[model samples]
Target: MSSSAFRTVPASADVVIVGGGVMGVSTAFHLAEAGVRNIVVVERGELGCGSSGKPIGGVRAQFSDPLNIELGNRSLRAYRDFPHRPGADIRLDTVGYLFLLDSDRQVSDFAAGVELQNGLGVPSRVISPDEAGRLCPYVSTDGLVAAVYSPADGHARPGLVVQGYARAAAHAGVTIATHTAVCGIDTAGDRITGVHTDQGRIACSTVICAAGAWSARIGDMVGVDLPVRPVRRQLAFTAPLTPPAPRIPFTIDFSSTAYFHNSDDGLLFGLADPDQEEGFDTTWTPHWLELFRTAARHRAPALADMRTVGGWAGLYEVTPDHNALIGRSAELPGFLYATGFSGHGFLQAPAVGEVMRDLYLEREPFTDISPLGADRFRHGAEIRPEAHVV
Candidate 1:
């Protein structure tokens, strides 16, 4: 099968993934490796053309929940093992991540999150504000009481990771439809039998809805309302300064809302929006710059001189609890739900893909998916909220 084969022919399959982001491609690849062919992945746009292509490239295991810790750890392993590629390697830089202690409550919760990450084999620890400055010489440590530092935390290029998964899936004979969009679901009785798409209809027994920001919309098509909504996140880039500032780590100021890192040519930066708290809008405004500037000054005053070269907005598939909602949907049989990743989708994609594969192929899940299942929401189960949800 060639790259353009799907464009020339209308094909059917045993499984159809309804969003071609990192989740869809990663699942398709692993599923193929599990010996289940006839897999078709449909994307509303080109692969990695969604938020997968627009991430700030953050990867870390510093979460309060053990499930997320496991997910982050599992995905980090895969990233560590990704075969070396020339040109644009997904630079896995372990420059460390420090979540600055903001308040007493923030400090207490970070202690718990660090303990959880450590229990799950993550090398995260609590560090004094001075230690935070040691890791990133440019960081402003004034009034910063303490920090939660994860030395194992780092970042990888989003486009490279997406392409790696897509290439591996294609090499394994998985049908990856780049420009296809799943319009709706074709159901008979209580089970899904096929998928309705703009290109044509696809006959399949199992369907995985990995459609990130559009997850809620996809759920509506199948009568399963996924509580996933897109919250716009803006990232700004700066031109390289002289001497490169000694390879800074990905630092987050819990005291403030600032986060910054060293990119290839320059540095990448992001901050929380002061407005809405959460929403599904990708529209950008000047207010975001204010938020970034205010946070940056409180965290690292040196960054105040850095002028923004440009910025782009990406939607975070956020849930009510700010954690990913993964598992089977009860309303729609033979259909599984895997979205509402909040902002952890990219880092957790590899593990989430395996979780989906295990559920679909009847293999033992790497970890328990019961906690993340949609049934929890139906039964009024609460997802444990993490204070360090960056």
Candidate 2:
């Protein structure tokens, strides 16, 4: 749909969502499934126009944090069976996820992580460098002492998943207004009154902040300081190889935080910039390519010969603890949060949708998300950080 159709916002809605990415649409779908259909999803631009569409689509359960592992497990199941549940084929391929370790210290940390992941039924195990090479034949495993491989972890088409949720939500009578920018969140004495969009005002008592990188801005409107900051992450892809490489698992060099995976007979790779400044800046830089080239050559020497085809930049809604902030806000009663997943939001959207829906309906959530609440930061509680976040 074009922006022209969104010239006028509805007078009111039972619930007003601030973003139309995968998280918002999935939340709407789950809410509709739970018999709440009077929902409005307002997107500033097209659905999945943000980080949701730009992720390399890696999904895994090999996490150190217990809650993160649980979220990943549930999301993995949903991705495996999403075609029936959400009625869309996301092209989920469980080739696997392999993390290469360059030192014994990393191996030791990963071993502990594997123990916890296996305890939670993740089936992650440590392997020798030779074994890792066998898993990914092209990767040069030099200077690598160990590796962690989880066969259940994989990648999927992120855009398709978002579209699937949007379709399901629309079918369930959830109104999605694209190109509608939210100007302000109206409140009256600590209670949400409505949302003022660029088009018009929407009289909604409940407002959900699923605005991805812009979540903190939305929080500011309601007098709440959501500790979510936008950080730029860049990815580059190579043209199709001459001899099509074998299906490669999502491989990460844990030391440098550089990773790559198979995509369209080519390779999709990226690196986390250590000097990247916080804020919304999506410019693709040559310095990033240089950093990635060095990392890739050290991990997979063969990749040095492949010419760069194209790439994109996206935002990571990084929190202080590199986790998510979910649940209702104490400052404002009806204001809820479903953002700040760092870079793991796309993979965990399915399970988060269900959890948020349950919380909104005053039912017991499938998993205990108390640790991920905003109050954790305020109360000075110890944050259980996820170790493997590439």
Q: Please, what is the whole-model Cα lDDT of each candidate in the order they appear?
A: 0.79, 0.87
Give the runs in model 1 whose Cα sits over 4 Å from its true position.
1-9, 84-88, 277-280
| Clash pairs, model 2 backbone | none
Error of 1 at 182 (Å): 1.5
- Per-residue lDDT of 1-390 in model 1, one digit per residue for the tens? 234425432457899888888888888888888899898888877888777876458888888888888999998888887764212257678777778775778788888877777778999888888988988887888777788888888888888888888887888888777677777888888888888887788988889989998888888887887887777878888877666657877888865567888886777888766464566667766567777787777778888768767777878887777877788877676888688887788999888988999999777898987888766667888788654245
Q: Model 2: runs farther than 4 Å from truth? A: 1-4
lDDT of 2 at 139: 74
Q: What is the TM-score of each candidate against the true structure?
A: 0.94, 0.97
Clashing pairs in 1: none
